[model samples]
Target chain A: MSRVSSKMALAVKCSDTFNADACMHCGVCTAVCPMGIEMLPRKLFRYVQIGLEDKVKENISTIYSCLLCGMCAENCPAEVNIADNVRFLRKYINENEFNLS
Target chain B: MPLPTKDILGILADNLNQRKSVLPISSAAATRWAKGLDLPKGGKTVLYTGHLYQLIPIIDAMSGQMAKFEDSALTKYFGLGRNVNKFINMTFFMGMMASKDEQKDYDRMLRNIALLLKKADVDFGYLYGEELYSGALVYDEGVDGSFAKHAQRVADMFKKNGVEKIITVDPHTTHTLRTVFPEFVKGFDIEVKSYLEVLAESGIEPTNQITDDLSLHDSCVYARHENVVEQPRALLAKTGAKVNEPRLCGKNTHCCGGPLESLFPSESHRIAGNRVEQLKEAGGSIATMCPICLVSLRKAAKGSVKVNDLSDTLAKAYGV
Candidate 1:
């Protein structure tokens, strides 16, 4: 069985057109994140915008560790929905069959 | 004998609106204030037993002298009472007595608490100095005849009022009214339910069509105490909006750092921030049930995610 099946699947699927063009690649999200799990909100936004689902999934734990408070969204010059995208990614990860290796 | 439903609903709606606009301190503060009033030494101890909703501060106040009263536990759970004297004097005992105006405040607080508790099935008694001081009022019935009678009268009024459905918004009221009051008030026909349950049952849709994905903040009162885990989710699901479940959801839901609000505002902010991060990780706008939870989470939220109440959501969904 694939590790994808081993992990819990999300009930919702990520929309293919889920875009994060507004992200400014600022490190503010990483700074305010309570867990101290380093993740560049802009970089994740870039990868997701480009349809790099594998790259987004690679950093899934860091994304999952977000508290979803929206400090980064407030601070973002681009006003990217960082938290929403993170949730979308989580739902995608849980719902879709993806190869971890 | 039933009270008019419109009147009851009006009262409830007014109370809910008041609570929403003005943040009432936890019931624990009232208990402490009551203790500080220096009720004559002989007064009976009217135990208001319930969950750690607002009543926790009161419970802590009453059990102040007991060895089991651990300050650290309170600080750990609630983040109150850094100093021993402050814990005992300020947080616990000092709140017992307020001035005349303060007494009015106390009356309002107590009345609201009473109404909420009555709806939940909890009975309350006014403690007289003599009975409390003497400790003569054991667990036996009629130990305090007048006190018991007054409680019975209130319960009877509720039963006569056609209050077939009594929903408490606060968990402390729910636990006490549902679990403890039945022991004292015989033949009380009120069915204690939580406000979240009522909201869920009302079938009100989320008014705000949140196209953005969202997360659910499981409040301690709604999630752990009342087991209202699915109701909010069901409401969120109604919006046809995707919900991201947090790692620490449902009964395992974290405190929004509410208990520590007074004691360690900054640390509480950090805890709230931490929970917000979890919601963010789940990724989306945040929805909660409890008013306190909504307020606490919003303060910490700092606008990272959208925070709204289930009712507010339904109002948006229904365009009401």
Candidate 2:
């Protein structure tokens, strides 16, 4: 039942802060995460990059659980803003799913 | 079985929107720390707590309740609790569970910051009861719309008070005021500095010497976002205390697992326990500059190692 929405992908790509595409999948972020959530910014960025809404939805609890401590973004050789990207997903979820705004 | 993130976030947003703080603390309780300090009301330069330190005990108490709820079947009722909280403010009862001694401990830390500023001969005023919570938790939780509105309100309050500069107490408040606020509030030109930064620049020599080793836990906001890494270290150095850096320090500092404390208590504690292990390996008494870090590490350490606010260590060295 899940289909990629170009709109969602476009919105995420256009965000200056959510540089998920720049993620190199090096696992540096996962190594540093205190929560030890295995996928974290690395896999989460991949989900965002491929426009896998279902994947992101499946990991919604994981998304909300991020510490957003910037430890990943700081250590990322790709210089992706991992924490801000997580914030973007949270903001996205808050708006689309929860209808907070 | 999933954490009730939506319910928790919704409740926090509602509180921020209505009460001007994520937690509903009375003005009297919030301002009790500044009593007998004789700090003036407002001026061009002011000390803005953002209630980060003041709200800690309540946050701790509520998190304890939340941990219990998470382990039991009561977790499902969080949605109903959120709805009920809209009218009754159930967190008020949670706030009652905050230990008086813990509240006083946090208050004393604020007092020490003030006393240290005075010792440095830096002139600052307090907003006292007029201060707002800076919407840090909502902002951190990605409740941007609520945060934006609250940030505007805070900026307007500053404008009304003629506050040109703000000296912040904790890292989260410092980062929000220094970096995040400017983005949300256009022309938000207030000069923001942490008391650590102010004291570092002041070259305030400590009145006493503490020849003890300490592990400094840097708040992620202060270390990475705010570029406040050296200020606290330099201030601590003046106290004659040698600070041992854990594996992750400075811009690469690890989180205290705080940002998730409200939404995911168990995960937060798990992270905190991990950080405590790293800090303990570094050897020495632990010193955390941020209130969240202090509480998190202290909870995880569980008296295995002494964890304290940096202010307590600095206050001891300053003989305040």
Candidate 3:
């Protein structure tokens, strides 16, 4: 059984004001990433927006891997601030998971 | 080396904050800054180190802590065991590693900037033991709470000290103070200027001359984020060397890869290499505006190109 959390989605959304709902899933952010690391911004948003906590958890590497360089946001046709979203996810993951001394 | 994890980075931030800095790095740089100084004369201009230059000794030490992350427990758990070089990012453990490396060059660059500003009579001063890290690394690493607290403490210290204005040395500090602080702290008001902005405003003509072709590698923060692109070129124009432009220059500049260098070393190296290739194509000794850019780009260029901070370049121009 997989658990879903509206709280996580709400928190992530609040952390980054850019409405992921307006995302056309156009794959432009992935194309624009300098690292050429696809499967992020759009993919991560899709999982989070749907409240799939497990799926979001699974993509932790992809979420934190973003440099938050704003390159994708700069190039986004929809004007989505994907970099801030990545930063939010990173903050969410660090607080929700992981043990740090 | 094993990849740096949140646990490690968090712990390191906690530790560094406990002491207010990587003490060795700060203390060593302080020793250098104090050299050849007379009795204290108070100045209204607070020369904020932003803990970047002071942390150089620690950064050099930490950047050297590479291990076999390909087989580490974290890598195996994350399924990041393959593609060793390209996949790993540094944790704060790497950043906290203890070493005895000489911070002379780092210290020298900082001193030169201070001396140049003093020569230009900006009435600059440092906070000595009171200065704190701008929590930039923690903020960038997504450790928001730690950074917020640090920012508050730094802001409070500034208020207590009656710091009228600040001249920041690096872009990370400059950007954090100018942009990030306001968001985290209410009424986080203080006049902040990067040293380049200070120099440009001073309009001092350099007495020393450079015969070499001088090219500029703009730090992404200094160039794109802060719009401090033309000021350094203007200074170089007045000083001596004719400025050369890389393919990725000005607002469209490429990053030096330092931010990701911690999070993605191999990829950072690859980007930096590409940037260096672009810079070398423009063909000249590289002059940089940020300390991190000087380190990252120099790591890529590997001494084939002479790289220096704009502070050092101007210091030479003033025959310091």
As a TM-score, model 1 comes out at 0.40
Name the candidate, 1 or 3, with the larger DockQ value. 3
* lDDT for position B232 in model 1: 63
lDDT tens string, model 1, B67-87? 233334432422122223222
How do the residues B289-317 of candidate 3 rate in per-residue lDDT, one tens digit apiece? 78788888888888898887778778877
Give Cα-based local distance difference scores for all models: 0.47, 0.88, 0.71
Q: For each candidate, report its DockQ versus the true two-chain complex.
A: 0.01, 0.82, 0.39
Best by DockQ: 2
Best by lDDT: 2
Q: Give me the runs in candidate 3 sitting further than 4 Å from their true place.
A: A1-4, A16-28, A99-101, B1-4, B22-31, B38-42, B67-102
- What TM-score fits each model? 0.40, 0.97, 0.86
**Candidate 1: where is the Cα deviation over 4 Å?**
A1-101, B1-162, B170-172, B183-189, B202-212, B263-267
**Collision pairs in model 3:** B1-B67, B1-B68, B1-B69, B4-B91
Interface RMSD of each: 22.5, 1.0, 2.5
